[model samples]
Target: MTLDPLPLAQALIRCRSVTPADDGALAVLEAALAPLGFACHRLRFGAVENLFAIRGQGAPHLMFAGHTDVVPAGDAGWSVDPFGGEVRDGRLMGRGATDMKGGVAAWVAAVATVLDRRPGLPGMLSLLITGDEEGPAVDGTVKVLGWLAAQDLVPDCCVVGEPTSKVALGDTIKVGRRGSLNAAITVHGTQGHSAYPQRADNPVHRLVRALAALTAEPLDQGTAFFEPSTLQVTSVDVGNPATNVIPPSATARLNIRFNDRHTEASLTALLRDVLAREAPRHTLEVSCSGESFLTRPGPFVAALERAVQAECGLAPKLDTGGGTSDARFIARHCPVAELGAVGATMHQVDESTPVAELRALARLYARVIEEVQG
Candidate 1:
């Protein structure tokens, strides 16, 4: 019996599983997977719920990784309830309808379809679902992958079902992601009256010069499969109310989206060097979300391409452009790629996915599993 992804998706959406909150979303999935002979294991890490379920135990293992969490549904106006999981005009509407609950349901339905056809197929299939992807992301796939590795349950390759498509179902597949680095720089100086320009050091001037040097040139002209790296100054503040008093310090926050051309360490070093040259007395602090990574074209990627063409009738463009996802962590374990539904309305008011597209995505995932496991 083939499972309809709509009902499952609706059930998932009904659970207000906002970031770091399970709200029984994982339980809903576990219920569906359990009846399919999957051995489910619930793993909780620091207030986050996660599940790792396996249907088989052998080589040529394939893992499906995703999250059940959705970003907060802001108080923005909506035609339907954000958590109601309403289906109107052949589309399922909810907070996570497209960003991922739809993809999760599609994968479950696809697995059900595959196993119903070949109940005794060789090799293993598993799911690594987390409830922390939309939150801090600290206690999710990264932690579960570690547990799986300790148990010798690492898969050969993993597919993250993030909303990777651009315009159509198979139009694009994310093969990599740009790294994110955030920095806070404070320029120190002696404070004094505004009239005494020569006596008092102006930190704001030093800060402006430092930022000018940082933004004077492009980080890089981008790289193959990725766009040019970008740096944006998020804020510059002296926090002084008195206009006549020169502030003692100036602080600025900056963020950089870098391609594979630079590592977080290298970029930090570059910034530090620039600070030294521009503002010798400035203090700096840096934090990295994740380093950029790419899975260069190979047989695994070829399998994805073939699956996309055969199932969706579209040759997917192998892309490496997007914000960081769980794929960044999975990339360290194996060659990872991301593919799923069109993300046109993810995290927006009236988030939705067409029922027809849901079924097509199921077929696409089924084909991908077959091609990768064959």
Candidate 2:
């Protein structure tokens, strides 16, 4: 019961796992879990690494899901090596420290602690970890869930370690997530001299008109249990370097984070309608990352709330405002939620978590396992 998550967490952060690259990150986790009796399955799918480690069986299955991938450490300077896993001024400094290697470590250590107290759990305990989370996500949790379903290993309920906490280690629990869709619009027109604007069809002008209409109206008033659906244009490309020559085509990319009121199909139709009206000759390509999902308040939620209240002394707020995560994939298989440590610095330079908070989060996961199992 005296397990410290710091060592394991540091080991994970040191792997330099920038998405789709394991760099031995999964092996580090497997090493930590194997001695504790977990059957670690190293799953590789199309250059992406994943793991499904479980130690128990039967009803009330509690799965701790997370990712080992970290985003690239950009040009932003950090006092410590991004992969050094240094502890300075009580903070664990690294790329994945808080955004999630920290959470994954906490859960593993929590399991070790719980096992020390209760060697044999009454039900199943598992961990579904993926290395493709920060990448295209095609070869991660979604595929793992398929394999789990095929083998009848799907869990009863699950929690994703996605650093949902806003101000403190346990201040927030994400109960649902808005769906995500990415759109690419390419408007084509005949190339012409810039001096002859009236002679050539201007694709940039058409593209801007379409984008304006898409953003002119709000997706919706905020929905209960969710913020309003949002659409944002992320990129605009013409590929033409010369200002004197009119571009033959203009391309724009946009994303929509929508609520349960809309599905990918509905949102896609809406986008097409606007594009057809404004840029009839354009081509639109759309891919849905996830449709919005909500796990309604019930016994599972109550158990997580009780765990936070007891361990952290704060009644955690059940929230649903955030970008998409692997939770969106798990929600399709079972009731899933998100919880972990403070995320104020995730995906930023100097991303980190206090050593004290990491220990506290492990204790919280221990409590959560107890609450939900009973």
lDDT of 2 at 316: 91
- The CA root-mean-square deviation of candidate 1, after full C-alpha superposition on the true structure, stands at 1.1
So what's the TM-score on candidate 1? 0.98
Estimate the overall C-alpha local distance difference test score of candidate 1.
0.92
lDDT of 2 by residue, 131-170 (tens): 9999999999989999999989999999999999999878
Tens-place lDDT per residue, model 1, 227-321, is: 99999999999999998999899999999999999998999999899889878888999999999999999988999999999988878998988
Which ranges in model 2 have alpha carbons more than 4 Å from their true place? 189-205, 236-249
lDDT of 2: 0.93
Best by TM-score: 1
Which ranges in model 1 have alpha carbons more than 4 Å from their true place? none
